[model samples]
Target: MKGRAIAGIALILLGAYLFFMRDENISTGSVFAYFWPTLFVIPVGILLHWLYFGVFGRSAVGVLVPAGIVTTTGIVCQIATLTDGWSYLWPGFILAVAVGLFELYWFSGRNKALLIPINILAGASLIFFVAFSISNLLGKLALGQPFLAIVFILAGAFLLAARKSTP
Candidate 1:
């Protein structure tokens, strides 16, 4: 995680990309040309938040939530840009918020202050997923909808099992 180590890894990745460009049909350079800002913005934001949290001993959910949001948004943007599916990526924002809220809820020792946002964001992500599916943004079988359904089912089952076993 040191600066020199990260720089070395980045250089190695770049070297690999350059070496693979001849065989690949896509242009990695072009992609980087367009998304360079995102490459820096996302990691730097997350790193800052993580450093801040580390200083606090990772006990602060507030920092963790924002960090997760920043990281997720960056990754979603990169994927959408690469795939040329900007419109289809709209749901990712909702998902990022939901993830951040969930992280806050789960890591903040289940603080009551984080509950409202967690529920709200999670609901919003579901709404967006359904909307995307009905609109066929990514096709009839939008991946998020099924994944969300499975997640919901699994979570519900787990909660039920936990409750039944609790006495």
Candidate 2:
């Protein structure tokens, strides 16, 4: 019953959107514009991986995870587009990357190098992204100065200003 209700609601909304927003200018290609990201998940992803595998074979198995992850990030970007949710959903891409790293680590015989970065990225995304999107952190960050950028600039400047200590 609940599922039917949700489906009904979706149908109604789609109907209203068609009635109010539809135009003769709308073509199949234009309709598919919103879903362009799916292309990356399919033809681009499959074709590139196929080509890579053809050239490198299992020796390049590690490429699979990151390629799949590019698709995942594209998927996340697609979702964010529908409602302009990038402000909150950007972390989701980071989380997706961490997930891809875990896949690599798992499938590539558990490389110790992947474990540290995976844990760090997953932890940072959970802590920072969740806090920014769900809690008071969003308000503060939005309202506050661009301190993060400033800090980055300052760090770069400091590096440039420093004298070489190597003797």
Q: What is the C-alpha lDDT of each candidate?
A: 0.69, 0.68
Q: Which candidate is the best by lDDT?
A: 1
Ten-residue region with minimum lDDT total, candidate 2: 34-43
What is candidate 2's lDDT per residue for 1-167, written digit by digit as tens? 97998789557645644554456365667545544665445456555466546887667767767766676677676666554567777887778788778867875778899999889988988887776675445355684346656878999999999999997
TM-score of 2: 0.55
lDDT per residue, candidate 1, 7-114, as tens digits?
996786566545545555547676485466366758865685766566775555578778778877887776666555566667788778877777777776787887
What is the model-wide C-alpha lDDT for candidate 2?
Answer: 0.68
| Residue 44 of model 1, lDDT score | 68
Error of 1 at 77 (Å): 0.5
The runs of at least 3 residues in candidate 1 whose Cα sits more than 4 Å from the true structure, single-residue gaps closed, are 1-29, 58-60, 137-167
* Highest TM-score model number: 1
Alpha-carbon TM-score of each model against the true structure: 0.57, 0.55
